[model samples]
Target: MFRVFKTCHLFKQNKIFTRRMAAVNLKSLSEDKIYEFLNSFDTVLTDCDGVLWMDMTPIENSPEVMNKFHDHGRQTFYITNNSTKTREEFLAKCSKLNFHATKNNILCTSYLAACYLQDLGFKKKVYVVGSEGVSKELEQVGIDHCGVGPDTIKPGVPYKTFERDPDVGAVIVGFDEHFSYPKLLKAASYLSDENVHFVGTNTDERFPMDGNIVVPGTGSLVRCVETCAERKAVIVGKPDTYISKAIIKRFNINPKRTLMIGDRCNTDILLGTRCGFQTLLVLSGVTSLTEVNTWKQSNSQDELDLLPDYYVDKLGDLLPYLEKFKPTNASATMLKFFSKSLRVSMAHMLANKENYERFATQRSNNSLLAVTYSLSYIRIDSKLCNQSHVTSANPSIIVPIRPDITEYEFLFTGNHTMAASNLKSLSEEELKRFVNSFDVVLSDCDGVLWVENEPIPGSPEVVRRLKLIGKKFFYVTNNNTKTRAEFLEKCEKLQYQAKLEEMMCTSYLVAAYLKEKKFNKKVYIVGKEAIGKELNAVGIEYIGLGPDPLVGDSLGMIENFNPDPDVGAVVVGFDDQISYPKIAKAATYVQNPDVHFIGTNCDNQRPSPNSNIFPGSGCMLRVIEAAANRKAVLLGKPEPYISQTIISKYGLNPERTLMIGDKGDTDILLGKRCGFKTLLVLSGVTSLKDLEKWKRSEDKEERDLVPDYYTDKLSDLLPMLSNS
Candidate 1:
């Protein structure tokens, strides 16, 4: 039960409460981590105003982020609750700010108000207690509206003598510069007939203020009408059903394939929860981490609805990942590491200061450089500070060199810093040593082995060689859309040998996760029959598997909806049969407060055989997230849970394990976090340019995305394996 505190002191007391649930902070993660999160959504529904701008000034890099989504073939829409602006006005602002948008991609409160009235088939006039934006939008839909001009309250005016229009079948409330007592009286008089509808553009309690001064929101006036007429108004904006239905129907959006990015949890995150879109909260706007923590402790379901699936410090931080780059000339590079120490003999070093200074000056002038470490102490002239070589008694002292020295570079390569990449190709001797170090191999299926459904060159030979040599390998995939049996069948078709136990997929991991947790309750499934089958195999019953075909008189299902008490969890994956009823049921079941939420994987796009894009499981998972207002335990790549299971089940040693994958964010990031050596194969997704960006980044989080090693393709390892 949700408790409304009458006193401010009780509300303050609520802040200190503790809860286990928390949003995953995407800001601190590597570039690969952010990429995995972004790839899980097909459509992006973003809130404007605070998220993209502070009133007028654009938030840094927001425009580029939206454009990047478009470049990646993800759909985007700007949804706002500011009813004062018409569609055209919003478009003008978007254009000025360089936000990549179109008329079809913008969804505002005024436009939603017009859509709601049209859906209602209300031919009669609407008495609007708002601005010209609402009236203009209503006009576009061929619906007549009035009450736009000033209706200011006069001191001597007789309130009882106010006239009403009989043709006014509805009262629409929005932001109004001319709102007065007379307009309220007129609107209430018309709404007295319970048949006359009352529509509110938004229910925001207050507008974001500049300082101490707070402006009243449209919700204030909507309350006045409701208080007078004793009837609840239909809200058309965020956290409401009207806009969600409109956007879904207009765009034919798949709920399972959409994302909602916003700053405010109450409106933006709440809307996402209602629509089943994955929500990303940014701290660049209205919400703070402290407010989210307070919500985490709340028992109220409404408070829970405000939680986002993931959050970033700001949207602009994604710029470094998306920025374009061109690789430098690779011919000039040289391999550097040799036996953990330089081969230069310290006995040959000159102890004389003048001799050392002259030698250092000549070497510094030349671009050619070599780094040597010695325990012996030697002093050089202070004037020769630009010298390439510096001898110190301190073994830890590192000699600094020119920035343009690309022939050989010694980057701080470790678990704490970004993984260093070899600028040059690997030698035959080096490849053999690298391949011999790992005892177990964990490989990603889609990109590493095949692109679009066909096996890459030399990939099959490499896998066969590993198997022939008795190397233990696991085909780990975030492809929860298909079952392990299906995956094994695909492997057979591709001529790649695999055992059922050797395949680790998100679906199987999800089932294993539930079984390990000892959860015996039935599950509400928002996915295909394959997921249901997996659950059944683990003795977990499930409902809402296939499409719940829409019926003409289906309002009864919603009105009389009753969730099963035995249903203790909601698991979401790719569901071709997804429908309104399935979403309703899953959302309802999850609302029980005790029902756990689980997602197979957060993969948004699948690589098609023809190179076309298809929605992945993340879409469906998002839909349940929006409706249930809860986060899911993701059992897939980049999420530590799946890796933990694989580690425990196979008894694999992280120190001697190599994780090979095409995508760096999911496959490589997963390997890095699991304490395994990661090798990035440029057979798909991440490019050499992408790797260079992470390597050059100052942000430690972005630097963490760099892989321990990289190769042109997985096939490059075949020659060394064959010789072995």
Candidate 2:
């Protein structure tokens, strides 16, 4: 028998449980409905500990259910609030329990603690009031830390006698077996200076109570420090959304299709709800049905966030439906909060609370209908489009709705929906008109045309369609790793027609810059064969092509490195075989002050198809700049050099051109600077969240990175092109 709490009489007798939440019970569903529900999600983000097992013991059939979920082509991630265990430790635990796991699949607060400090560019030592887990994570990021070992209680000594480390910049609190008055005093003393960062692993008040034993969790220690320090700490665990932000940033998660499963309401369910992920509550842990009923009767907004969209007796309950499921592309009707045209649809559907209550109360099919935030909107599934006009509502409050899209799936970073009173998204007519206005299309090759070595789905067809429509096409790339000939071959392999004159590469532009200046000297190159080939093609002499051999010193003296007299410039690009000798040689050449320094591009990371990021040319260029104490003239996108080359050589008009790429900082900013329209596609590196960062930033350079328009993928535009 399922647990039932009749807290119905605790509140106003008129209110009911269904009014607060209509969570669907999977056990009540038919086999077909169960299959459909199971197949709806592509990813499952489950809370560790209670949901999977209790301490070290595995929950019955939970591991089997997880393996089954993975078998059905669904991605599974273990999200946990426990900060006492490092990711490696957690992975070991998962392995011991026979659970399928990987390092990338886990997001624990201990790891988040280290990531937080790293993001802040912290170089100082961390004073930890936790375990080896937090210290291990900090060590992994090359962050020095202290205060990990047991601090034995000294009953007679005063707290003021303890000396604090001057280098400590942050105090971290987690589960500690040796937490005492001395340690607490040390943490509080460090935090007395308000400038010091205070990070708490989580705020979980208590651990799951073993009968007759109530063990205090990490929060108890954190609260002790908070009380003594009289300062609030930034929580790095779930329900705070810091971990969620980091996870989404690392893996481009589509919230709409992602399912967050957990056993607790406050942390697990609330996080999923706050992040706009579909939530499922299991009844095997901390929260009981009685607490849910109490919250429902209270009618608290915060309480409402804790409610789950669906609930089950246990996670293993869905195991039977795994093999029988058939995934489909269909989606539920979505209400677009930011689109102004939605007002018309709002009038037709149920409006106001009274109307919604009547419609909701009439339904008794046991199927849950989760009516989330935004009351002034009606339900309709539609695609988002760009609009030129700004409405009275804050433009940042945009919430796009498509049958297949969700708030999480939107992938842009921003606060929760700020009720759009008068905002607008473009209509179908506006989109068609927008597409027809562009006469020439200039696209970034790495992210826009192809990802890694493979072409993005439907991209080649889009290029062919644009060519068929008489739109002049050009492939622009900041990847100096590949020569123009290599890029041309890649285009041809992907069925994209190309010409030598129509392509603009950083290496080619560097060659052009050298040729135009009539440099009659050799270059100290810190790049690959691609740059060498381009330079050789333009009749420019160069050295430092292959690995620069290290010079050995027999005595206790430094090896005297000298630059060739003929070297008049230092050129850097993406070199997989870069070495200290090469950097020393390049730096030695550029330090002459007469020698010019030119970098191919400044892209930080190269995007890969399998979602891995490799450090790009910018890293090498920065190394040379730091060593030489001078900046290089960057010649790629967003820099005027490449744009100058294309305009001067091809006579391309900026007014009729459209720049497309997956990177906003380069492709979008370049378009804005060159007076051309820009479109950001999600098929590559740049996520909707990354674009939103630049949109919200107060810096002009950041604001300039915003794209004129965006699409989920490049293929999304194919239908519009066909219609046009």
Task: List ranges where model 1 is wrong by over 4 Å.
Answer: 1-417, 420-424, 549-557, 609-612
Question: Backbone collision count in every prediction?
Answer: 11, 3
Considering every candidate listed, which one attains the maximal lDDT?
A: 2
lDDT of 2 by residue, 55-114 (tens): 888888889889888887788999988888899999999999989999999889899999
TM per candidate = 0.48, 0.46
Compared with the true structure, all predictions reach lDDT values of: 0.70, 0.71
Alpha-carbon shift of residue 256 in model 2 (angstroms): 1.4
Error of 1 at 193 (Å): 50
